[model samples]
Target: MNIIVISSPQQELNEASIIGALFEHGLEVFHLRKPTYSIYDTEALIQAIEPKFRDRVVLHHHYALAEKYNLRGIHFTGHYVKSHSDQLTNWYDKAKQQAMTVSGSKHQLKELETLEVPYNYVFLSPVFDSISKAGYKSNFADLKSIEKYKSATQLIALGGISLDKIDQVKRMGFDGAAVLGTVWEKPAQAIAVFMELKAAWEKKDQIF
Candidate 1:
């Protein structure tokens, strides 16, 4: 089970330092998602991170930075894909040519069926009640349906993921788990939570 961490939407104190620590502690993927950031602001944030770990970073916006920084991949939001339908093929082809992983977010299971291009993985969110978004309860109830879809493409469980919920995610047949609010809400204890989650994930793997 791959453990992915998403950056807080807004910058937090010592954000770069925390990111560097996450890499040192074996965080495999870090998604840089800042919806309101200008291109320059995004670039500055990336620059702030240690150069050695840049390749492990994924961009939610600023697709061009994937090449500029030799990033791990680029993640497309559902809205972005829908708005740029005509350019999806080109983006996919370019990402492949650059040998970068491609991923996206899908809120609905039905949307996964409609994806024309292959993604290395896709985030299926609100699997449980959201930690970051108020009042955003889990809408996922069909584990059987999720398992059925997992066979076609790698599905990563996102939203409200925590150490305790890791086992539940694995039992549901998800390929990976993504963390956001659980880490950011208490950045001071982020490392401890991350280590706990990682240990739980590895222990689960050992059993199954």
Candidate 2:
């Protein structure tokens, strides 16, 4: 399973430093998803990351920065998908022309059935209880049903993912897992937590 780290919605102390360390420690993909940041703020944040590792970063908004910074891709949120339904086809074509990878988030399995464009991957959240959101519990009860949708596109497990649950995610056939609260809860120890998760994921891969 691929281990992805998402930037905290709100900036944290030494945020850029934490992200830089994560890249050095083998973080392959870093999702920069600051909802409130203006385009300039987002540009500044991306600029702060080391240039060599900037290609591994994915943006949630300010997609125009993808080409400017040579980012890995762009992620569309559920709201963006719904609100821009009419413009998605044109947007997808343009993103493809730029050689950018495309991904999106879907809160429900039903949403996957209606996806018009093929994405590199899509995040299906709350697979387990949410670590960051209080009382946002997992609604996943039938893993078999999730497997059926694998033919449509790669599905990534999000929400409440932690070291202990990495195996569960793989067993359920998720292409990857996204980490948020577990890493941000202790920013100083985030790299350690990620290493542990990465080690466990590798072990599981070896077993299978």
Q: Which has the greatest lDDT? A: 1
lDDT of 1 at 28: 88
Model 1 worst lDDT run, 10 consecutive residues: 142-151
lDDT scores of the candidates, listed in order: 0.88, 0.87
Q: What is the lDDT of residue 64 in candidate 2?
A: 81
Number of the top-ranking candidate, with TM-score as the measure: 1
lDDT of 1 at 72: 89
Number of clashing residue pairs, candidate 2: 0
lDDT of 2 by residue, 1-208 (tens): 3899999999899999999999999999999999999999999999899999998998999888998888988898888887888977776787888888889998888888878689989999889899988999887855544677886578889999998899988888888899999999999999999999888777745544
Candidate 1: pairs in clash: none
lDDT of 2 at 40: 96
